[model samples]
Target: MSLVSYTKALNRALGDALAADEAVCVFGEDVGAGLAGMTLGLQSRFGAQRVVDTPLSEQAFTSVGIGAALAGRRPVIELQIPSLLYLVFEQLANQAHKFSLMTGGQARVSLTVVVPGSGSRAGWAGQHSDQPYSLFAHVGIKTVVPATPSDAYGLLTSAIADDDPVVLFAPAAALGVREDVTAPLGPVPLGSARIRRPGRDVTVVAVGHLVHDALWAAQELAGEVDVEVLDPRTLYPFDFPALARSLRRTGRLVVLDDANRSCGFAAEVLASAVEAVPLLAPPRRVTRPDGTVLPFALDLDRALQPGRDQLLDAIRSVMA
Candidate 1:
């Protein structure tokens, strides 16, 4: 079994997708230079026609991608930074995400938008480090945040293959994660939750990079508190059934999210959990303060993002 890093897995996924489907193509700024690591060597392998590097205009290229998708091409748009998504929010939320429904399900925008380094990336400051998956999920777009190397590979494949538009965020913190690949990698269905650690005391639902923090907390609290860590790979079409089953067994819940606390993905998960199942105690979530803008200072940047200590505290609170 060979060890595959998260970034490498993403690169492999794009390569495989390009090789497997003639309709699949990519558009982004500096993608041909492989700045994000996922598109490394893709241009030479797939040729410039398939891996076309567009001008530095997110909105323009995003619109072009939508047009290409409508014209029967599967376009994967790679955003160097997550916050650039704000620039093309109208294109994604209003236009591309609506075409399928606007055309009475006759039209589909098979477009995949991949954000390689989402969330705080060591003083990228406010402009570059925003994890806005919740916003996309709220707008009814398929949102994916894979937590591991294998999930990164599988979920990206599925997102590209999906007929509807999908936004996959590869959290910056998770980029370093590497796993031993014993079996062949393939598509992991969207909206599925993976139980990283099974326990009976409480279920800790962690999103994106926070999944790793939850797992670490679970390991540290072993024997004292059985914390079941669940990674909601896709936030929009969430695996509510899996959460309900976990909550039934644990009777308690804790959510670790990297985005803002108010009306974030964690809030949605907590809201849905309470309505769907009976809980032994009130659920809790650990997230950045409302409308958090990460500071440029290294320490402050790290402080703003949710970490293992916060997750551990939340888990203990639920267990109490």
Candidate 2:
């Protein structure tokens, strides 16, 4: 087994995709230099044609990726910042995502949008710190937030190979995560959830970076309560079957996510569990308050985000 960082896993995935398929090309700003480290050494390895360093126009280049996909090229567009997603929302959510359905399955845009450093990067503040997976999920875009290095490698490969447009959000909080991987790196099927920790008392569903927090909280409260950790790797096209099975075993649910409260991914998970299965206790969700704009100050920023204490309280509340 070899230990690998999450950022390295991402870089490996991009390299593997480029090596495996000639049609797979990457386009984004500063890709020539691989400024984000996710695309490092890719331009030289894959050549300038395949690893394109696009102009500063995100909206225009985003649509260009869609066009390339339509022309039979699997284009992976790397967005250095997560908020840039808002700028090209129409290009992605409307054009790239709607192609297959709008054309009655005749047209497919096999495109992958990679947001390398999503979520808060300490003092990155309001504009650059948003974790917008919920936005893509709401529009039915295939969205993935991988917590571990292995998942980062596997899911990125799957997203590149998918026929539909997929958005892969690599949360900044999780970029530092490393794992000891024994298995040969490969693709993890989309729309699947993994049970990180098994328990019978309550299921703690964590999103993106919160998976680590959930696991820690579960361990901290191990003697007092049994907490199961469920990581829904793919936010959109969620693995409802796996979640249902966990819910059946646990009978209680608590969601810990970094997104805002109202209409967030956590809410969707809670709602779905309640609607489909019987709950032994009222489910709870720990997330940023509704309409949260992360403050610039250190304490204020930390205050607005969900943490271990909030997750622990939610678990206790559900147990009570």
Candidate 3:
């Protein structure tokens, strides 16, 4: 088996999509130079037109992508940072995302916005470290967060192929993750959750990079607590049935999320799961503090983000 890193898998997915569809094109600030790593070497292979680099303007370029999508082009916008989502929120939420619903499915905007390194990147404090996938999910837009290398490949392929506006976030922490591959990578459905580890004690639903933290906490507490790890590959159009099935086996729940505590992804998961399934104890969620703005100091940054320790505490609380 060959080892494939998460970024490489994403690159492969983008390459495959471009090769398969003549209409597929990419727009971003430094995509041609491939500064984000996921678009590395793509420009040289796909030609300048297919992998066009844009001026340093998220609003202008994202608007261009929206227009291109409306005109029958499958444009993938590669965002260098996650916070750029805020800059283009009006364009994404009001313009691109609304086309289909506003026209009653008559319009199709096959646009894919990919944030290669989302969430906290050590020193990339405040503006750069936000994990806002939950915001897109809240607004009824398709939102995906793949945890592993293979899932990264599959989910991204599916996102690019989707006939609507889809936002895919590759957590900063998960980028370095590598996996052993024995089979070909392909598309994973937009709204499916994967059971990373199965157990009977409690179900710990993790989003994006926090999946690794959940797995680690589960292993660390293996003897005392039988923790189950569920990765919600897609946040919006969430696979509630999968979560329901897991909750059937384990009567407790805990969500490990990287976003802020109030109205965050973790909050949504906890609220939805409690109503759908019966649980043994009160559900708990471990997340960044509400209104948390990550500090530039490495220690402070680590402190602000959810970690395995917090996950373990939440899991144990749910089991108790």
Candidate 1 structure quality by residue, lDDT tens digits, 1-320: 99999999999999999999999999999889898899999999999999999998999999999999999999999998998999999999999999999999888999999999999988689998899999999999999999999999999999999999999999999999999999999999998989999999999999877888888888899989988999989998999999999999999999889999899998998999999899999999999989899999999888887888878787777777
* Model 1: residue 270 alpha-carbon error in angstroms: 0.9
What TM-score would each prediction reach against the true structure? 0.99, 0.99, 0.99
Candidate 1: global Cα-lDDT?
0.93
**Ten-residue stretch with the least lDDT total in model 1:** 311-320
> lDDT per model, in order?
0.93, 0.94, 0.92
Question: Which has the greatest lDDT?
Answer: 2
Counting clashing residue pairs in each candidate, in order, gives 0, 0, 0
Clashes of 3: 0
Residue 286, model 2: Cα distance from true site in angstroms: 0.3
- Per-residue lDDT of 166 in model 3: 96
For model 3, residues 48-71, the per-residue Cα lDDT tens digits are 999999999999999999999999
Q: Give the TM-score (vs. native) of candidate 1.
A: 0.99
Candidate 3 residue pairs in clash (backbone atoms < 3 Å): none
Model 1, stretches more than 4 Å misplaced? Answer: none
Worst 10 residues of 2 by lDDT: 291-300
Candidate 2: lDDT of 138?
96
lDDT of 2 by residue, 42-68 (tens): 999889999999899999788889999
